[model samples]
Target: MNWVVFAIFAYIFLALQKGFGSLISLPEAFGGMAPSLLLIFGVYICLSARAYLALWAMLALGILTDLITTTNPSATIIGPASLGYLLAGFTIIQMRGLVFKESVFTLAILTFSAGVFAGLTTICFFKMRSFSWLTNDPIEGWDSATQMYRYFMMVLYTTVLSFPIGALLYRLSPLFRFHEKKSY
Candidate 1:
């Protein structure tokens, strides 16, 4: 994938995530979860590109996402989001050959699973950070039950949103021309 094009898309998604993400919300019963558009996009790109390219892309995306979205005033620790995204990317890339990548159902499942993995990784990091003596900035409202519930809801919401986004990406794949055709 062209770095320029990827950067453009990254900026756009970041803007949407930062500016308009709150405006869109799930029902109150669902904890008003907003879908992670950036994660969805990252997963889509990871699934579409070669493993090597996807690794770098996911790393860049993850770092940018952490920089943009982190609520910590100190910005002390940076690896949680990046680590989560890398793990998710690696898992998807490893499983890529087993699934039909072009199928919306497959994409949704991949997105959902990846989202859960990323969410769990992030939660674990936060939990560790909260307990560590080195950090003054511990995660507030540290209820494991509530956090896990919210994470599950967010993953589900992200999965629901991924279908359309995946379809759009697949439709525009010809223009980007990132993925290579597989030979028999």
Candidate 2:
């Protein structure tokens, strides 16, 4: 894997996720869905790359995501997003061999599943931290039911958006292909 190329892609993804993601949002009633472009990109990279490459990239991206999105004034904790992405990466790596990576159906399923897992893992991390020794207060407005509903909506939205994005990525696979070419 080319580190320079991967870094450029990661920066572009972060910019998109931060700049364009906020512009597109659903109503509050429907959980105000905001698409996770980085997560989707991570899914694509995981499916297309080797295990080691995918793991490191996902970890770095996840940490960067947490740093960019952190708004809490009380604590400086930043493991939720990282942990979530790591779990998602691992899940995709484990299941990569079983599914057709180029299939839109497979991408959709994997994206949705990974989104849900990331969301739940994030929630769990926050919840755990809230009860830890360092914190005396719980996360504000922490409603499990509402959070789960919002996560579900976000997962659905991400899944729907993944189709077109996945198609484009699939078409461009040759550029980022990890296998070595052999001359006959």
Candidate 3:
């Protein structure tokens, strides 16, 4: 996988995720969850890239996520999302051989599954941080149940959006150059 291409896509996806979040978000009555474009792209990377490349991509995506989603600008903690993406990427790499990576449906399913894993891991990291001696809270709301529900809803929304997006991305797979390095 080409790091330059990966970085370009990462920037574009992150921009879309943040720039279009309000437009892409569900109604307030429905938990107001926004589809995570980054997660979908990250899933694509994990499914297509070789194991080592996938790990690095996931880490980069995670760090990007951490940087952007920081609630408090004064104190930025960057490990939660980074670790979450790494773990999710690792899990997907382990199971990639069992899935049909080229299928859009497979991409949607894996996106949701990985989204759930990474999202929950991120929440847990923040929750643990809240309990620590840190002066500032990492996350705004400490309501675990509500946060979990919202996160799940966001993942579901992202999964729904992944079908068309994944198809397009898969069509552009050659440009990404992942086919040559794909793990058999």
Per-model root-mean-square deviation over C-alphas: 3.4, 2.7, 3.0
Best by lDDT: 3
User: What clash count goes with each model?
Assistant: 0, 0, 0
Candidate 3 local accuracy as lDDT?
0.86
Q: Which residue runs of candidate 3 sit more than 4 Å off their true CA positions?
A: 132-140, 179-184
Regions of candidate 2 where Cα sits further than 4 Å from its true position:
71-76, 132-134, 181-184
Model 3 clashes, total count: 0
Per-residue alpha-carbon lDDT of candidate 3 for residues 109-178, written as tens digits (9 for 90 to 100): 9998899889889888877766757644445655777778888898889999999999999988888887
State residue 86's C-alpha deviation in candidate 1, in Å.
0.3
Q: In angstroms, give how far residue 151 of model 3 lies from its true place.
A: 0.4
The model with the greatest TM-score is 3
The 10 consecutive residues of candidate 3 with the worst lDDT sum are: 132-141
Model 2 root mean square deviation, Cα atoms: 2.7
> In model 3, how large is the Cα lDDT of residue 145?
77
Per-residue lDDT tens digits for candidate 1, residues 1-184, read: 7667788888888888778767876677886667788888888788788789898888887787677755466554677778888999999999989998888888889888888888888778887766657565566666666767877898898898888888887887766568656468
| Quality of model 1 by C-alpha lDDT | 0.80
